[model samples]
Target: MARTPADLLADALRRDAAAPLLTDYDDATGDRVELSGTTLANWVAKTANLLQDEFDVGPGSTVALALPVHWQTAAVLLAAWSCGAAVLDTATEDDGRLAEADVVLAAQDRLAPLEEQEPAELLGLSLHPLGMGMAGYAGPARDFALEVRAHGDFFAPYQPPDPADPGLLAGGVELALGDLVGTAQGLADRLGLRPGDRVLVDAGTAAEAGPVAWLLAPLAAGASLVLCRNPDPARLLQRAAAERVTATLGVQIEGIRELGRPA
Candidate 1:
């Protein structure tokens, strides 16, 4: 039987609980955050609980993601899948597809524009390192950071996700949960990612390559991510060395093999 994305995450949690799963850096903001497999799973649990309890998201439900490639974005995507819901990529224009989502999770910057769409449930994420609420913004949407903290650390979904259910909705394409896992694994293999590989990626490339490259590929390969946003080219070599990056996706670094491309 083909495993679901959630299952893969769970396996990572059990196998490498203490290993660093994600190291996020935003050079433009001078912000950095690292999450271990266990910590990442805990965040996923809390977000999943919030989705299932507050919004009644479950199998067949759709959650539109309007955020960028940040650490919090990973939690939101995993949480939606944990609740047996399909994740709709709203980063790209898709006509009226976003309007059909049961829930919309957007960054604070996108609230005003999304308000016009009037989704059934809108959640605004601060994307702050401390997970704070949006400042001075009076909006109809719920605050994701504030609400997620109130949820439990561990999640046991009332109904587990079915492998056959739609897991991803992107630009008119709907991929099943099993298909998502399969493709992720295939991408990982094609990239020659080995276990324990540390893959460095830039936010621009992550956003452009979609979730398969930014998120699932690393997970499927048993590798970790060093996700950099607004990276300074001058400091790229230093950062890659500090992170012990074995491979790179978006940016080319000296002495590191470029994944999915010839060195």
Candidate 2:
């Protein structure tokens, strides 16, 4: 069993690197992307290297994030965890403390206000389905998509993260990094998640559920994820069928098991 976010990904790679681990669907743009376990790990490694080498993000560092529910967001999160850095997600927190973070990564749309906070270091994610650079934007923040590819696809943190270190800060609540694995397992059980289960979750629900439920729980359960953004209500059933989803969050589909308000 995985004891950390990094361990969860390593376990996935050990099990079947080629297996699809995360599939993203954007109804608004009709975008679909699939990431195998190996591919996702590679991204995580590259991003982790960037964080540790460039910004000196490691144990005792905090990375502030103002991004949405997306695959790239997943990579950034796992990377931060791999470095043993705590995350202050703006999705659930205030910009008042964003400037206190060592590094801040934000989506283009959310950049203006966060930029105003004058973080020590700022990076922008295009959130492109194809991992393209931010287009038609002139900004001071460095581009994450371009910088990450230059890093190696393997990571070894200079300072190993201590399990007792803070892991996440959201809604004024704190959780230690060591507790994440256990919390995820408990959430998985509450949601009735089983190994190899396919979960379909909408972006709204995922955002509300936060990373522990929408991201870590599925990983902890050894379940693959199918995340939908800007979900079109009419296509829910068809999309769920196409994804072979056994469980759903934040949406009701006939015959599919909902996460039962656990998220």
State each model's CA lDDT, in order.
0.89, 0.89
Please give, for residues 1-263, the per-residue lDDT of candidate 1 as tens digits: 77888987887887789988999999998898999999999999999999999999999999999899999999999999989899999675333666789999999998887888788999999899867888988989899988999999999989989989999988678899888899999999998888889999999999988897789988998899999999999988998888888999888987889998864
Best by TM-score: 1
Per-candidate TM-score against the hidden true structure:
0.97, 0.96
Runs in model 2 with CA error above 4 Å? 92-94, 261-263
Which residue ranges in model 1 land beyond 4 Å of their true spot? 93-95
Q: Model 2 over residues 1-263: C-alpha lDDT tens digits?
A: 22567888887788789988999999999999999999999999999999999999999999988899999999999999999999998673346888899999989777777777788999999999999888877878899999998999899999877778888998888888878878988999988898998899889989987999999999988999999999998999998888899998888888888886543
C-alpha lDDT (0 to 100) for residue 205 of candidate 1: 92
Residue 118 error for model 2, in Å? 1.2
